[model samples]
Each structure stands twice: as structure tokens, then as C-alpha cells.
Target: MSDLRDLYQELILDHTKRPRNFGQLATANRKAEGFNPLCGDRVTVHLELDGDTVREIHFEGSGCAISTASASLMTEAIKGLRVEDARALFEQVHKLVTGASGPNGGGPSLGKLVVLAGVRDYPIRVKCASLPWHTLCAALSGGDETVTTE
Candidate 1:
């Protein structure tokens, strides 16, 4: 268990140190910004949808390691998925991080995202980890307003 925890920590650190898809997308057709007032995490999610598929996705933001890594991992996870699939994934990730379900408890198969399950132990950090995901929802739904976790 300790070894697994160390691996999870390492994964999070890796994504934080060098986040994936951390930039603006010139061709994005949908975009949304998110702010978490509790921890001052802010993120903007951009997407390019080809029909129902996400042809491209990117983000730009400044936040805690959790927030950064979550955004990074999120972009990677949802890139090739359809818009509706991406939305379902958001719910899965939300449950995974919030302890509504566990990796072995018949939750959505999180794959690389399982590393974030430890976040459930630190309730406050859940907001940090999920900031980008909520922003993604807003982006996908075409909501121009900034999503906030108050």
C-alpha cells in the first residue's frame, strides 16, 4: 500500500512539474473559465469539437499542483472522446476523487486518473483537483460564464 501511495505521489508530481496540454488552443470552438475561491485556483478549458468528438483540448491556468495535474490529466483523458463521453467521464472523475466510489468498487475505470484517488482523504483538496473538470463541463456546455466553487 505504501508503495502504491508513493507511485501515486510520483505521478501527481510528474504531471505538476510538466503538465500535459498546458497552453491556449488557437482553434478552440468552446471555452470556459473556472475559479475556486477556497484555494484560489483558476483554470480555463478550451476545446475543439469535430461534430461530437473533441478534436482538440487545451488549458491555461495558475493553481496548486493538484489543480495543474488534474487539468493536465484531464486533457489527456478526454481528447479523443466524444462530447457526451467526456461529460460522463467528468462525473466519473468527480465520484472517484470525492470518494463516492473506489477504484475496486465498480466506479468508472479511471485508468491513469486513479492516481488522484488519494485526494479523497483530503476533503478540501478535492476542490483544487476538480476545478479544471468543472471548467470542462462549462466549456462543453457552451457556458461563457466562469464556473466557481464557492
Candidate 2:
């Protein structure tokens, strides 16, 4: 268990130091901004949808390691997924990080995103970890107002 935790920590730090898909997408058709006032984390999620599938996704922002890594991992996870699938994935990840899913809940595997499950241990950090996901939801829903974790 300790080894697994260390691996998770390493993965998180890797994503934080060098986030994947971190940039603006010139061809993005949908975008949304998010702010976490609790920790002053801000992020913008951009997406290019090919019909109902996400053809590309990117994000740009300055935030805590958790926020940045979550955005990075999210973009990687959702890039080739259909919008509906991505939304479902968001729900799964939300449950994982928020401790809403109990042991043996048997949720679908989150793959690389399972690393985020650790955030549930830190109540306040939960907001930091979820900021990007909330922003992605806004972009998917075509919301113009900035999403806030207040």
C-alpha cells in the first residue's frame, strides 16, 4: 500500500511539473474558465469536438499542483472519448476524489485518474483537485460564466 501511494505521489508530481496538453487550442470550439477562490487556482478548459467526440482538448492556467495535474490528466483521459463518455468519466472521478464511492462500489476503472483518489484524504485539497473537472464540465455544457469553487 505504501508503495502504491508512493507511485501515486510520483505520478501526481510528474503531471504537475510537466502537465500534458497544457496550452490554448486555436481550433477549440468550446471553452470555459474556472476559479478556486479557496486557494486562488484558476484554469481554462478548451475543447474541439468532432461531432459528439472530443477531437482535442487543452488547458492553460496557474494553479496548485493538484489543480494542474488534474487538468492535465483530464485532457489526456477525455481527448478521444465521446462527450457523453467524458461526462460519465467526470462523474466517476468526482466520486473517487470526493469519497462518495464506497469500497466495492465497483465503479468503472478511471485508469490514470485513479491517482486522484488520494485527494479525498485532504478535505480542503479536494476543491483544488476538482477545480479543473468543474471547468471541463462548464466547457462541455457551453456555460459562459466562470465556474467557481467557493
lDDT tens digits, residue span 13-128, model 2: 99999999999999999999999877779999999988999999999999988898899999999999998999999898888888898643315568888888778777778888
Candidate 2 residue pairs in backbone clash? none
Candidate 1: 10-residue stretch with minimal lDDT: 101-110
Instruction: Kindly report the root-mean-square deviation of model 1 from the true structure over all alpha carbons.
Output: 2.3
Query: Model 2 reaches what TM-score against the true structure?
Result: 0.92
Tens-place lDDT per residue, model 1, 8-97, is: 598899999999998999999999999998777899999998999999999999999889999999999999999889988999889988
Off by over 4 Å in 2: 1-8, 103-108
Whole-model lDDT per candidate: 0.88, 0.88
